[model samples]
Target chain A: MKKCSQCQNNLNYNCETCILRLSGKTLFYNVPSSLLQEIEHVDEHISINTKIYEENESNTYLYSITKGIVKLSITDASYKTRATSLLTAGMSFGLEVINKSSYLQNATSITPVKVCKIKLAREQINESKSLLENTLKKWQENITNQNQIIEKFSMGDTHTRIIRLFHYLKENSPLEEKNNFYLPRLEDISSIVNVSKENCSRALSKIKKMKEIILVDKKSKIYKT
Target chain B: MKKCSQCQNNLNYNCETCILRLSGKTLFYNVPSSLLQEIEHVDEHISINTKIYEENESNTYLYSITKGIVKLSITDASYKTRATSLLTAGMSFGLEVINKSSYLQNATSITPVKVCKIKLAREQINESKSLLENTLKKWQENITNQNQIIEKFSMGDTHTRIIRLFHYLKENSPLEEKNNFYLPRLEDISSIVNVSKENCSRALSKIKKMKEIILVDKKSKIYKT
Candidate 1:
């Protein structure tokens, strides 16, 4: 290991801009203070429906959220979008820095979102043991979640997957909506359910036939009631 | 961060069963030798078709591959099995050990495989920064692969998904077979394609009709020629 003798000395571990302040809690709560001060970060505000980053871009930085929501998505060779997960306030991303990760998905702001960006340098990876641990924990959680959806649709039918997704949206609540939940682009929902847009539409129509969700705008919103 | 005074002094960083030695290379390449010695691990062999562990079983140790192949998979509430990825000779698993992770998937040996199991204690987590980093990198790669599959099939067709998955299997070569390859259990392949067994079979028939794969046995094995 290349231990930089001068790295720790005079390093600012406890700056006011510490990500934890905005995130409330984080995976690195236990990261020793001496190690924490060596890190640096910056925060920014993004508009609703903005593309934060794409899978192919190697921007060399990751984000921590202060407010709003971000949707992690992917597009295949055919140019269809699929929603991987939704990031809410107090969440952070970009663990790929430790491994020089080549991103294979797109990250977009679902609502006007406030986020903090941090530089991940080679020597600095040793500084955030907490962040790396957090990445593993969250990865497993997402994998489990995806498997449940796959299992729910094991009968090879799209209807159940769509129903479950709707149930998930109602339970999870997409952004700032007590009564006006906007369904995302059909393609996004389709990816989450592991089906195609047409299957997602068919599933949505099946739900409509059952009078479960009222498609208010005919484009995306669903009435709360 | 605890900085155990006695932790590094007597630790054994190098042993015959060392994970790095067996796996050829790993994320721990840069983990300080002092820290590496503080953690302990063991090597073991698993039989073909044997489950190394499951989502609910807390065996408390994780694996690093030395030989053979392991399938990281999940079984949904409906009893359908999905193989998420195939881990071969140079990989490791068990990031959940750091956080008492609730596993939502199962790890099974598809072929006879050798692995090193390492105990992950709270203090040891601080000691093994390299392992944690590797876990995050591998997790992201798997997630990326999954989204691509979802994206490739975004057209809402099961046949295309199966065809893509077949292409993937052929290119990736999850196991060692010269002229003939035995397709995994239909249910496992179906889960990867995110379709039901019936649909998977139908897709297979279509492929056979196209003269792409020749089924020689009562089970699903295709002739290379």
Candidate 2:
């Protein structure tokens, strides 16, 4: 088993090569390296369809995705589930702990996933400048992303919404893997775009006829044309 | 003209009586009174339909509403304008400067409005603990609000969307004025809810028949049944 050089731990990912530490796109990109060393984190592998956390669960740690995909969703008062976002490698979730005690949404793994869960101390975050700034930055991005999704999906018809969703997914795919993007199942995509599964399939057919997206695997992989 | 006791300034709305300082609903409610005195601001009464700020304009000062209403909106790439949010008395705008130098949305007065344009120093914000925490709080609320608007309006049908929008407007109405809510024109409400004007009118009529909302003015004011 390979060991981490910085923390001298027998793990696939450690503080030195942690996605939060290595990826500039992460919420902790600007957080000081020394401060990261002071924080405690562990890498864990989970199978597909596992619920990482449930809504209203006490938020105590920040989850960073080192591999695979995770879907964040919320169940409305009417009992309808809506997917808010899909997090891939280098993206982090659970920063809600910085401001709120409970998770506002359910995070479920869409694929077999690897995550580095970092234990967060409220006192430590309040005292650190970089940590606070990064947290605020994450908040800013969160709002911007929500707005983008609303504009892209809500304003358009089903077909238009599907096209826009594909573009967004392509743009937000893991930094290094841009050409061939990972797509969730059609049922999942339907939920994210707020449409029925049949309508989503119809729209996908129309979009495919237009040569907008070429489905590589007919299930999970797509390449933008 | 009344004089502000704190700054000895002859202004109708001054630091001593500023909405930001007086209202618990405001972003600046927790900011120290000593810091409020240190900040520079001016009271400006803008005419209805006046543009407060343009999208992409350099953000300089935080605009706190002392009276009346302001609509914040964004124009997408297709030139379609969407109303993102409506700000009323005690609410503030222009906090986007905390993370970025440019305003992401346009702010325009929906009614004859009074605003306290408080000059913000980026360096000062970074230096103060309370200011940072408040800013973070604002961001958290922003995300929560966006998600709420999405789930409420985006997921449901046009009729459902209008009902949800009314409930949201009722909930978000100026703190003291809950029973009688000030609503914008049907045209504006239609845009905010992402529905066509005709459809919005139709759904509103249905809602009105059901006593979901009683239109007091047949235009601007509504009473929830």
Q: What TM-score fits each model? A: 0.73, 0.78
At residue B201, give the lDDT of candidate 2: 88
For model 2, how does the per-residue alpha-carbon lDDT over A1-225 read when each residue is reduced to its tens digit?
A: 655433455766566666556556665666777887777876777666688898789968878787777878877766777777767777677777766568877888866677778787655666566676666666666656555655566556788777776666566555255655655677667767878889889888877788777766554454654
**Under the 3 Å rule for N, CA and C atoms, how many clashes does model 2 have?**
0
Q: Which pairs in model 2 have colliding backbones?
A: none
Could you give the TM-score of chain B for each candidate, in order? 0.67, 0.74
TM-score, prediction 2: 0.78
Candidate 2: deviation at residue B204, Å?
4.3
Who wins the TM-score comparison?
Answer: 2
lDDT of 2 by residue, B1-225 (tens): 865433455666555566556656565666777877777776777766678889889867778777777778777656676776766677677777766568877888765677778787655566556676666666665556545655666546788777776666566554255555555567667767777789888988888798777766555454654
> Who wins the DockQ comparison?
1
Residue A144 local lDDT, model 2: 62
